[model samples]
Structure formats: structure tokens, C-alpha cells
Target: MGFLYQLGINLAALLLPVSRFFSPKMKLFVDGRKQSFAVLENQIDKNQEYIWFHVASLGEYEQGLPVMEEIKAQYPEYKLLLTFFSPSGFEIRKNNKIADITIYLPLDTKQNVKRFLDIVQPKMVFFIKYEFWPNYLYELKNRNIPTYLISGIFRKNQLFFKWYGGFYRKALQSFDHFFVQNDASAQLLKSIDFNNSTVNGDTRFDRVAQIVERAQPLDFIADFKNNTTTIVIGSSWVDDEAIYLPYLNNSENVKLIIAPHNIKEEEITRLISKIDKKTVRFTNYKTEELKNADVFIIDTIGILTQIYAYADIGYVGGAFKTGLHNILEPATYGTPVVIGPKYSKFQEAKDLVALGSCLVVHNTEELSITFNRLITDADYRNELGIKNLEFVLKNKNATKVIMDFIERNI
Candidate 1:
């Protein structure tokens, strides 16, 4: 399996150059990796002590950020080397302030891993969530680097839990500590005799809680909101929009803010065509236009977290399509959240649903009904909002769990 994994990654590395022409995202994956070795060689200073943080994409980056930021603040002597395996994470956060340098993780083959580790020479390492490259993990273990898995989740179905997964299970031993999100994950590790783990909760709760603490008010959102029951539509997909747009178009005395998943001009234009009410785009929104508009579309990124703070109710999208967007972001701000039906897999989503803090709507009518109930009953809406807030509060300090160990060890 290890040999097969090696071959698979090498094949992927080889094909990346040819496959890049087929898609823009593929191009980014290929092109960004091409520059990674150069970026490290040029920027990474040999004298400075460095700690590494690796995330698969934007979501894991958010999950890992509180710990990264705290390390940056408290341990300024150690520089951060942030790496992303996906283009979506790297492109958006390459110039992020938290890390001294950011780059795509070079394809996980033996040669690349050796070269990367040689150049990086990190004092400690962190891998967010669950992208476990066998060669990298084994090499880090060989080097005796204290590698950690933060906000990690494991299930019975994963490779590590299978009888045929001995090669992959060995990779799990590379981590000096496993600051996992739940008991099931810890139990899974324990079942494999890898008990160097803890049920530390999800770091995202900590990240969002901190956002609510220090988030600056976006004046435009406040002015557009006009103190009404504003329903924030975050990271919406087409299917999600289909469920909510009818309620938006016909409803009054409530404002609509749509932060679609794709902000591409074509997607935004198509979305605008469906909305029968006055709409304004965040990029080109005029004060008068924004004030009068019933729908405000966020055609940009990075500010979505802050926007959740002003939401009376939040409809976090993607559950109807690929997956759910971050409901915790709005929920942390004491906003009642509504998501689509396909949320049984995510633990946080399932917990919120069971607690009646997060509403799940299967169809357009269900969405409308959910929105109407929240809009009509302030007490009920606030109650759900309070529950969501309490959930976020209760689950926070995962970062502290990680940092406490790091401090004692460092």
C-alpha cells in the first residue's frame, strides 16, 4: 500500500503538468507547486526556528488558525511555515499575516518529501484535519519532529481503522499528539493502540468565537440591514439559492444578503436574474443603491465571517450541493442558522440539529416555513440564537488545549 501510494502520488505529480491545461483549478495546483521549492529556498532562513502548519483547504485553515495565530503572538521567536495541499487554500491565503511564508505542499512522493523536509527543517509541525501523506508522516517521524493533528476527526470507515490499512495506520503514529474533535476520534485512535491523543473539541469554535469578540462592524451591512430581521445567506450554491430565493423575492420587512459560493461574474449575473427585487453587489454598491436594495450580494470573499455578526438569521449554504458552509460562523454571533438537508455526516451539524439550534430544510417550502417562523416570532428566534451562541461558547478552547501542551513541551 505504501508503494502503491508512492506510485499514485508520483503519477499525480507527473500528470499535473499535462492536466493543468484542462482547468483553471488544475493549473493553480500544478503552477503553485512548481514555485514551492523556489519559494522555500529563497525565503526560508536557515538560522530561524520554524514551526509548520499544513491544511488541505480553506476550511482546515480556519480550523487551524486560532492555534497558528496564538503561536505567532506568544512565540514570536518561532516563525510559521504554512502549507496547503489544495489551490483553494493556498491562493486565498498565500500572503496571510499569520505565516511568515506560505506555499503548496509539493506532491507527496519520497524525493519531494525528503527535499521539502530538508529545506524546511521545522522544529514542530501541525496538520489540520485529515490529509495524511504516508511518506511525509514517516519522514517527519524519522526526523523526530513533534507533529500534531489538530481538529482531527476519525471514523470507523477511514483507512486507519481497516484491517487492510496497516501502511496507512503506521502514518498515524507520526503524530506526537492528536488533538482530535470528538470522543469517537479518540476512541478510534485508541482502538489502533495509538493512544497519544485527546478529545480537544474543534478549533473552529474557538476561531469563530474570537471573530465575534474582535470583529469590526461593517458599516455597509449595518446601513443595508436598517435594523430589520436580516437573513444572511452565506456561501450559497445554486440548489441552496433555489430553496431560499422565493422567500427572498416575495418577503418584505426583512433584508437579504447573499454571499454565493462562486462570486464569478457569470454566477452572480445568473443569480441576479432570478431575484425580482432590488439587488446590489458588494463590490460596486452605492450608498443610495445599497440603502434601497432588498438584496445585497457579496461578490467577494474574506469578509463573510464578519458579515455573520450582523445576521439576525443565517442561511449557510452548500448542504444542498457539495456540503454545508460554516454555520458556526453565524451561530457564534448568536444568529439562528438554517441549512439544507444533507448534514447528517458533519458532527457539528448533527449536534446543532439535535439541539434545535440549527434548522435543516429539505425543500423550498420547508425553507420558507423556517424563515417565516423565525421572522414572525422574535422570542423563538432569539431562543434558538442563544442556543447556538451557547453551543459555540461551550465548544471553544480547543486551541488552548493544543497551546497548553505546546507551551509545556517547547
Candidate 2:
């Protein structure tokens, strides 16, 4: 299995240049890693002690952020080096203030792994949810580094739990500790005879809770809302817009703000053409002009958390297609969240549904009906919103829990 995994990694590294021609995202991926070693050699100071954190993408980075920040606060002497397996996370957070250095993680071949570890010389390492590179884990363990998997979620379907999974199971066992998000994950680890695990919940709840505490009123959003009930459609994709656009276009006395998952010109134009009502781009809108518009399209990123503050109801996107985006961002702001039907994989989404704090809609009609009911019934909407906020607050200490364990053990 190790040989096959190494062969696959080598194949991917060799074929990455060809993939760049077919996919722009793949192009970014290949391009980002081209100078990774050079970047490491140039930027990383061997004299400075470092704590390394690895995340697969933007979502995992957000999940691991609270713990990273707490670690930074507790050990100010240690510099932070963050790495991303995907370009989406690295590109967006390369200039982030939290880490002293940020770079794309090199491909997980033994040679590359050794080179990266030697350069960073991380005192401790953290792998965020769902990122398990066997080679890297093996190398870290060989060096006797204290490595942890934070906010880990495992399912029976994963290779680690399968009959022929001994090689993969070794990767799981490499972690000094597994701070899992739920009981099922802990049980899965235990089933594999890996007892170094704890159910510490998810650190994203802590991050979002911080966002809610620091949330301030956005003057432009306030002016645009104009005291009317507002529905924020955050991180919407084409499929999500297909289901909810018509209802938003025809609805009256309520404002809709869309922050599409992609902000490319073509996508923005396509969304605008679908909307029947007068629409204004966030970048182009004036405060006085907002009253005449029924739809507002956000052309920028990084403000979705703050946007949730002005939302009476939130429709998080992505569940209509691949999966669900972050519903907790809206829930943290005491807003009732609604998403599409395909959110079974997300534990928080399932828990929110079970708590009656989140509503699931299958199509345009279901979304319209759900929205109409929530918009008309203020008491019911507020009740659900309060429940969502409480749910977030109740799960707020996962970061502290993980940090406490790290302090004691590492």
C-alpha cells in the first residue's frame, strides 16, 4: 500500500503539468508548488522555532484557526508556519497576520516530505480535519515530533476502517492525539485500536463564536436593509441560485443579498440576468440608491461573517450540488439557516436539522414555502434564530479543550 501510494503521488507530480492545461484551478495548484522549496529556503529561518499547521483548504483553515491563535498566544516565542494542500487556502491566507510564514505544502513524497520538515524544523505539527498524508505523518513520527489531528471526523466508509486498511491505519496511528469533533469519530479511531483520541468537538464553532462577538454593524449593509427583513444567501453556487433565485426575484417587502461562491464576471452577469428585480452590485451601490433595489450582489469576499449579522434568515449554498458550505457562519449571528437537501455528510448540518434550528429544502418550491413561512412569522423565525445561536454557543470551547490537552501532553 505504501509503495502504491508513493507511485500514485509520483504519477500526480509528473502529470500535474498536463492537468494545468485543462483546469485553471489545477493550473494554480501546479503553479503554487513550483517554487515551494525555494520559498521555504528563502523565507524560513532555521534559527527560529516554529509550530506548523496544515490545512487542506479555506474551510479547514477556519476550523483550525482558533486553536492556532490560542497556541500563538500561549507560546509567543514560537513562530508559526502554516501550509495548505490546496491553492484556495494558500492564496486567500498567504498574507494572513496570524502566521509568520505561509506556503503551499509540497507533494507528499518521502523526499519532498523530508526536505520540507528539515527546512521548517517545526517543534510541533498539527494536521487539520481530513488532511492525512501518510508520508508526512511517517516522517514526523520518525523524528519523534508531537503531531496531532485536530477536529478529525472519521466514518466507517473511510479506508482506515476497511478490512485491508493496515497501511492507512498506520497513518492514523501516527498522530500523537486525535481531537475529534464527535463520538462516532472517536469510536472509529478506537475500533482501529488507536486509543489516543478525544471528543473535543469542532474548533470552527469557537472561531464563529469569536466572529459573532467581534461583529459590528456595517453601515452600508444597514442602509441597504432599510429596516426590512433581509435574507442572506451566502456562498451561493449556480445550482443553489437555480433553486432560490426565482423566489427572491418575485418576493416583495424583503431584501436579498447574494454572496456567490464565485465572483467571476461571467457568473455575476449570469446571476444578474436571472433576477427580475432591480439589482445592485455591492461595489457599485450607493446608500441612497439601495431603497430602489431589491437584490444586492456581493462582489467581494471576507465579509460574509459580518454580512450574517444583518440577516434575519440565511440560505447557505453548496448543498444543492457537491455538499454544504458553512451554515454555522449565519447561525453564529442568531440567524435561522436554510440549505438544500444534500447535507448528510456535514455533522453540524445534521445536528442543526435535528435541533430544528436549520431547515432543509429540496427545490425552489420548498425553499419558497420555507422562506414565506419564516418571513411571515417573526416569532417563529426569532425562536429558531435564538436556538441556532445557542447551539453555536454550547459548542464554543473545543479550541480551549484541544489547547489544554496540547499544553499537558506536548
lDDT of 2 by residue, 33-94 (tens): 98789988998887789999999999999998998899889999899988998887788888
Itemize residue pairs with steric clashes in candidate 2. none
Which stretches of candidate 2 lie above 4 Å from their native place?
none
State each model's CA lDDT, in order. Answer: 0.91, 0.91
Q: Residue 59 error for model 2, in Å?
A: 0.6
Q: Write the per-residue lDDT of candidate 1 for residues 80-159, one digit (tens) a residue.
A: 99999999888888889889999999988999999999999999999998879899999999999999999999889988
Estimate the TM-score of every prediction. 0.98, 0.98
Candidate 1 lDDT (Cα, whole model)? 0.91
